[model samples]
Target: MAEVLFYHLTESRLEEALPDLLEKCLARGWRVVVQTSDPERRDALDHHLWTYRDDSFLPHGTDADSSGALQPILLTAEGAQDANDPQVRFLVDGAEPAGDLSRYVRAIYMFDGHDPERLAGARRRWTIDKAAGHDLAYWQQSEDRRWVRKG
Candidate 1:
């Protein structure tokens, strides 16, 4: 069974919170795939990952990149994201979870907490993933802006 995490983005932007999470996944030697709803979102994230910080670098490539198979992190759209054989998958910007949960060690669904639609979507996903028997955790911003897992 895959470990599924739902990250409620309230205090931080997706661009701000995502790179650090991706860095942690890389530190664990896990190949990652960041799946977006569309190619435009994928390209935008691809650009942000490269320049998110001046002092840091996250080595990643896109599905469109020739070296997708060799990348530590692969940013892709809804179609055929298995090119990198990712161990971890991050679903962002309203992207739905990839159907084959067993293929991934961990799957993260990140959504904007301030958006009513996103919040409802997360709730719907929670119910589905729970029914599917995934070990689930929901993380939301605390008073101090740290992640606090809630029931």
Candidate 2:
């Protein structure tokens, strides 16, 4: 079973925290897929990954890109079954977990704590994933703006 990590975003928004997390994934030599339910969110994240850091760039391509398999990071909306065979998947902005999650080494659910709907979704996912026997972890942002394991 794949490890499921739920990130409760309280201090930083998705755009703010995602780049650092992506960089960490890259450091581990893992390909990544960042999925959102909305196509616009995927496009916005595509742009953000480019401009998020001035000194470095994250190699990412959207599903519309022809050479998706060659990209280190693939961003797409929901219902994308083949997403570059990434080792990690990031579900942002209330995106549901992809159906074939066992293909991934880890699945991360990044949800905004301030949004009621997102919070409910995350909780539901936590309960579901927990019962499904996947290794589960919960993290919340600390005052110093770092992810701290809460459970």
Candidate 3:
């Protein structure tokens, strides 16, 4: 099952969340593909978190070319399609929750309570009425979060 986890964090929280998120996915034996909008920040993350044997990294806007290393696949919006690698999991940072999210079997969307325009755009683009799948999730720190498997 494909899984996508999206996170919306304050710039201050990114350093904390990134490592924990990466470790969590690694512990679960999931191949990770991360998409970011910033090249420098992505490169920094690649330098710190990427290991030759366990992870891989690519900067946003870089080519889709990949090393055989198990490192997480890193990319930008233009390279997002490269995520076609099978059994892959996605971690999108500072990304709006729109687009063809149905490409993954399981996904998580994090909200930051700002960017009403982007949020509304995502709501319009990705809605339960149009998506197809068994498990769909909406998690807010304030709500009861659970997976909803389609019938």
TM-scores, each model vs. reference: 0.95, 0.96, 0.54
Tell me how far candidate 2 lies from the true structure as C-alpha RMSD in angstroms.
1.0
For candidate 3, write residues 1-151 as lDDT tens digits: 2343334443324444455655565556555555554666556555555442345442222223454233444443443444435234343444543455555544544334366754664454346424544243343322232222322
In model 1, the clashing pairs are none
RMSD of each: 1.1, 1.0, 6.5
Off by over 4 Å in 1: none
Instruction: Give me the runs in candidate 2 sitting further than 4 Å from their true place.
Output: none
Judged by lDDT, which candidate is best? 1
Per-residue lDDT of candidate 2, residues 33-109 (tens digit)? 89888989889999888898789889999997888888899998865545588899999999987585677899999
Error of 2 at 72 (Å): 0.7
